[model samples]
Target: MKTDTLFKRAFNDALLLTSRLRDGDPIPSETTLAAELGVSRTTVRKILQTLTEQGVVAGAGRSRFARASAGEVQPFPEAETVPTSVQVEKQFMEWMLRGDAKAGALINELDLARQFKVATTVIREFLNSFQRFGLIERRPSGGWVLQGFTHSFALELFEIREMFELRSAREFSSLPGTSPLWHELRRLRQEHIELLSEIETRFQDFSDLDSRFHRLVNTAVPNRFIDGFFDIITLIFHYHYQWNKKDERERNEVAIREHLAYIDALLSRSRSAVATACRRHLASARQTLIRSTSDTGSVA
Candidate 1:
């Protein structure tokens, strides 16, 4: 399909799956979103025209489109966490649960792209990824609508992490009473501890390393099953917890410290210590999840 048509399909499909909403759904102009989505104004206009032609939305003064009906989705308020793509989608899901129909408000694409500091195509691609997940549905008249609960999705992600991480924690601690890996584990643990000793409150590291840290530890077991188990865990984190921007903190040094403690527990060959450290780490992660409830109340 032509690039012009591709964006229209994405935009319209997103509308169909999502319901109507109330205040603060900044549905803007085609001219603007066209730039935001990185397509031509003609392309965006085509999307608006298509939606207008359909009964889903009505044009507002030839500039914007008001929904044919504003329905009942509420908002899920959250703060900045791992602000990645997954978090964006979770934000949208929360809006759906509130029955907040305002999610369809068009954003200034140029502004959005600028704020994200990324090309519009990346944003568009992120939105498009949701389609395969069945999170979004297309309208006959040509618009998209969100169809899932945001909180439920977020919770589901956490539950899955708990199951995988707990088991991986056990395997990680299964090293021999005296293995060379123990020394390496000791070094990383000490550093992790010193940082944690000076701990404060909320902190987040918006890097793949945060993820790689877990993977590296679990993979240390050198068993196919252990590796496979965490591969599943990794997939969930990749898709569900993908965040956009991380909230800044004064003491993220604590997490690195905890990670080292976890390493120490594993090297000591003490299952209890390993599990305790893992639980502590996961608890902190859960707090981050809770705090990440987006106040802006938009989703991927």
Candidate 2:
């Protein structure tokens, strides 16, 4: 499992377990909690630290942990921990979605690191991930600039995206109903409906949701190359296109409905139906990317 997810699971489990205890009740040892949760002792330690910070538990150097006094027992802590790589990506995407930077704008590693609370190397590595797509450029002197996609750039990438997704949809159609992917897809479908219901007030949130929905759809495929292309594809089609606010609400509403159709088709387990839905959504995405790049003032 992803470290962040494991950490969260352990955190929640810790909270639930501790809620059952009272003042002066000794909490389980790190090793015991680790074994019970099937996570590392280090993960348990992190959870304990959070609990300590929230006044859920109390201990020090050589002291064993015990539930804090009734008045001292604070509410459960918020889920905000250190930012994971996935979170960094979403923050970066949201930054774009909010028009924080424009196309062709220069980006400094230090500034991005500060903005995202990540290291300069982390920012550099993230930019490197998209280096193959040519939307980011490094200067000989210093720094990077956000680059715009040419028509040729979008068309070329779309061809590869179409191949990858179609193949994924074909394979996903045959997956057993018990597959975890189905559970995730169903969750995504519900999210689409929820977002669509609130589209007018929360239209800007669609870009992140759209990125998540497509990423979940492609999870059945196991090709590293396809995965690499997905980063670029999502950055452009999912986040960048929304830089244009023209009929944004209408476009997002339609896309959410299309996503519901796509989800239903996949759950039907018919290869032909899945293919049709995949093509329809991808074609819409392709058109959006083409239009976004062509519109002079849309980039941000």
Candidate 3:
């Protein structure tokens, strides 16, 4: 059988077994269970092992098996995990970081609660912590809003990021311990090029490339703080860089070429060339954004 099919069967069998047994129902013998499920003994063993790990069932000596006790609903099995508040906040945070979270569209404590399937109180506390991180805000209306960055914010972000990259390239290019940052940048730049070639849809593709390229650039920087800059920069770019909607393709290709140049300069240790490339790259985005804003008028 195809691995996909086998895995599906194994999963479905486990789910069926889980549903069939009542709370505290006696577990069946492995052989009987395997035969009944129409699966091989080894497959049954693997399934049972997985169930045991999930806290759904347990066993004892001489092949005895039993249902999970009410207390057995532990933190949750790896497969059936209930995402932590942090994890839920993280999902909401991504949208705030890169999404256009208008007043009506903003994610709040209630949204997080529904999204994570946890209590509203948990989400509220977590969102307050995000506000402390400067990632979100609560409105006077009892609704919460996500604070996004501006174009100037993006410029400052990239500037800080470049400083980190310049230092990392200088240090790691000649060092022995840490991984070469330039190499990773080159790989991601290549991936950006590939994405450009493969995608034809407009904003969505650009959005994806925008995210990936910035991440790649940030990776060149050694500091995590610098890496965090991209998180904010993405929001700024998406909100401000309108680019006439028609220029998306050309804009992306030009970006790809410039990124390639940036990576080349970093690899070759050409500081002047890197600085020049970065300037032109940013200027292009600025020009496009300004043009788009002018076109957009009060519609903005």
Candidate 4:
């Protein structure tokens, strides 16, 4: 399955490169193509062989040339290129975020597999991994049950989250101007601004953007442990957003503004400013999560 995914991705990339060439343009050499496509020469050779068979390219070895015009070559379908595990994870997260599964809800592997259109084994494995976080548990009768966020869970999670994020934010502020992360940070800041402009109708969109912004901050100083913890953070916050709908638009708007302040602090390269902004935003988020969980009777 891994090899098939790699080949399909490379094949799609080769198709894209081919589409850019004139009908008779010489194909790049195996080494150059491999480097450009980030694949092994063997994979590149396979791609060239397949392209030749499909009449997309002509000739053999170093003598290859394009035979198809830009309009003629078709890339693989987008869905075919994504790994099955990724597809399952995305679908499962979407299911949770859509509030299809409430806190403490029973999770049936067969039902989720059917709902997600994947093998039941896939769902089982995903749940098993997720179970380690204490968010879910196995039942003796069969199936798993969600352990919804409670006030204590919110406090504990935020305690670690704050430590990780503050360290990352400080690291981010000290990044050299040439770092590409600066460019990404700028791009996300603009996205926050745009989302804030349409906050009333686009409020739901903030969940994704919120996740991206924090994830980017952590990239400044990557820690595998922090990275893993973020998976839980992302899921729980997504659940929080879905489960707590009171003043949803207003709440999101405030968060967006706080994010802008945080971004400005990072961009300023002021360590003190970064710390202040980070603390303020995290404090607000902690309170929000605690308040929401406290009000929800479902939490245990």
For each candidate in the order shown, give its overall lDDT on alpha carbons.
0.54, 0.75, 0.57, 0.84
Range of the 10 consecutive residues with the lowest summed lDDT in candidate 3: 291-300
lDDT for model 4 comes to 0.84
59-178, model 4: which lDDT tens digit per residue? 996688998652365677888888777778677766654556676788888999998887788899898887756656788987898764556667888999999999999999999999
Which structure among the candidates has the greatest TM-score?
A: 4
Q: How many backbone clashes does candidate 2 have?
A: 0
TM-score of each: 0.43, 0.60, 0.48, 0.68
Q: List the residue pairs that clash in candidate 2.
A: none
What is the lDDT for 288 in model 1? 58
Q: Could you tell me the TM-score of candidate 4?
A: 0.68
What would the per-residue lDDT of candidate 2 be over residues 3-35, giving only the tens digit for each residue? 376677567777778877877887887888899
Off by over 4 Å in 4: 1-3, 69-71, 132-134, 138-143, 148-156, 170-222, 234-256, 263-273, 284-300
Weakest lDDT window of 10 consecutive positions for candidate 2: 291-300
Better of 2 and 3 by lDDT: 2
Candidate 1: tens digits of C-alpha lDDT, residues 1-300? 112335544454436433443332446666656666666776666666665565445646554545636543222223322335654545444434344544334433354456555566655666566555434555566445554424454466567667677776686677565656556556555544544554443233322445666765666555675566555445434433444235434325545666767776776768889889888977776665555433333333
TM-score of 3: 0.48
Clashes of 4: 0
Residue 243, model 4: lDDT of 67
Model 2 has an lDDT value of 0.75
The list of candidate 2 runs beyond 4 A from truth reads: 1-21, 32-56, 59-65, 68-80, 84-123, 130-133, 138-145, 149-156, 174-221, 235-249, 263-273, 289-300
